[model samples]
Target: MSRRRPTVSTSPSWTVGDLTVHRVDEIPLPPATGAWLLPAATPDVVTGHDWLHPHFADAQGVLRLDSHSFAFVLDGLRVVVDTGIGNGKERANPAWHDLDTDYLGRLTSAGFPPDSVDLVILTHLHADHVGWNTRHENGRWVPTFPRARYVTSRTEREFWAGYAMDEARAQMFRDSVLPVEEAGLLDLVDTPADGATILPGLRLLPTPGHTPGHVAVELTSRGETAVITGDCVHHPVQFAAPAVGACVDIDPVRSEASRRALLGTLADTDTLVLGTHFAPPTAGRVVRHEGAYRLAPVPPVAPVAPAPVAP
Candidate 1:
């Protein structure tokens, strides 16, 4: 199932071999988010990659990043990758604080109501990525997907356990992450240097640097493959300059090495790269461009509604 065309949906999905990965819409991050998150990506750096325009950047070169999740049912498991910044969370970042978007409604429209999710994969413990892990209910935070097992890397969990976190991060854990763990629903896996296979065809590839325990998800079905970039590669600009990294990266050097390594394997391959923060037309393939790399955009298939049944 390598290199299949995308299938459209009201929720915007891409068909990888046999699986239809839905991009559940969350609120678009403020334009300022680009400058704050990836400071190294200057206007000059961005405008140089003309391919990024109209989709990934403006004519002014301000990057267009999004906050969304990928939902799909695979081998009887209904999965969600990286819950976006949830509603009603208290945060220091103005863009993410006290969001009131109808994220749950959008998820339900995509056929994945919170309760129906079987697994919640946390790429890392960043506030934006894990904000939807729980919901404010009855004056307390509770696991939104009470029935699902929330998973993240053990190393990632342990790193934060010992690190000194500011009030904001600690508050994020109190509201979004801790409740799931307290519910005995959090599962931490040991991701080695190579990676770890969590299911038959789903693998977690170690993509540290953005975070100590961060990982990018790899999905395969019918010989077709797609890799979800979980913060390791935020924007398409990185495809053109893998060295440019996120500002919050715990280890900038390792982040660069990891980015280089991941891009190296993906370049000129048939695998579809799904960017966690990429704006619309979010999925694409890595290609060699002017001695570096670029994402050849893959737009979602235009959605067609089901035909009416005879009365």
Candidate 2:
């Protein structure tokens, strides 16, 4: 008898008018810390293991999922949202150290040239979120997207600039962020007190808590809408247990409150939700399931799947 392998499902992509959306996949971390940001009541339930593993044995035994980075295309503009962990980053966790990304190839595979990106919108200045902001060239960190403008929240910029100096996080600023600023491509956006439209169909909505200056990007066009959530909510588990906050969260209480409110606002809307760290097919619709919210992945059908054969 031979063992059968689980079918691998590829991430989905879609176009909103002229904007082509790409979901870039990355490696996942096993749950080694018994307590997850959102833990399940029972160990066997898939919910608990979906986001993070509680033990190394469980992590090795279970099939780990991929994290995602999103790219938004609009009017001859290729806007990348949240650069995943980059190469050569010094962190306490070895897993996140010195990541070498083939994101340029990934972008080309998605049909957009590397230099074609017009804007790079970072939801925050977290290490994982800005890793790809630069690439190593001539033994130095330089802008990855040479021609693109990098936009980030002013509050986030100031916070990290100050926090990075005394904290271990300072290396991220010196390596990834400062270079972008020095290149004159960094744009500091004012944290909108009330939601404000940044582009024709794009709006910036305040959803502070994961970080002091964190904001969610809302896109709308011809009755279609989607919200690109950064770390405002890390995993699907938070939908049911909104109070659960990741250990890295700056303000757990505020993060909890913000999660509940954002979930509620989209609970009844047709907005397509995009999560930065969400598993493959990161783009989805939020639905009420089993008395709580759940993400229903948007199925990719145009690219046909292999037909099954009888044994």
The most accurate candidate by lDDT is 1
Question: What is candidate 1's lDDT per residue for 1-311, written digit by digit as tens?
Answer: 68533332488888888788889888888999898889989999999989999899999999999999998888877899999989999999998889999889878777777778889999999998999999989999999999899999999999999999999999999999889989999999999988899887788999999999999999999999999999999999999988888889999999999898999999999999999999999999999899889999888865533111112
Task: State TM-scores per candidate.
Answer: 0.94, 0.82
Query: How many residue pairs clash per model?
Result: 0, 4
Model 1 vs. true fold: TM: 0.94
Off by over 4 Å in 1: 1-9, 304-311
> What lDDT does candidate 1 reach at residue 135?
94
Highest TM-score, which number?
1
Query: 12-106, model 2: which lDDT tens digit per residue?
Result: 56555444466766556545422444443234544343433321124433322344577766644667788877777776557678766666666
Candidate 1: the clashing residue pairs are none
Q: Report the Cα lDDT for residue 248, model 2.
A: 75
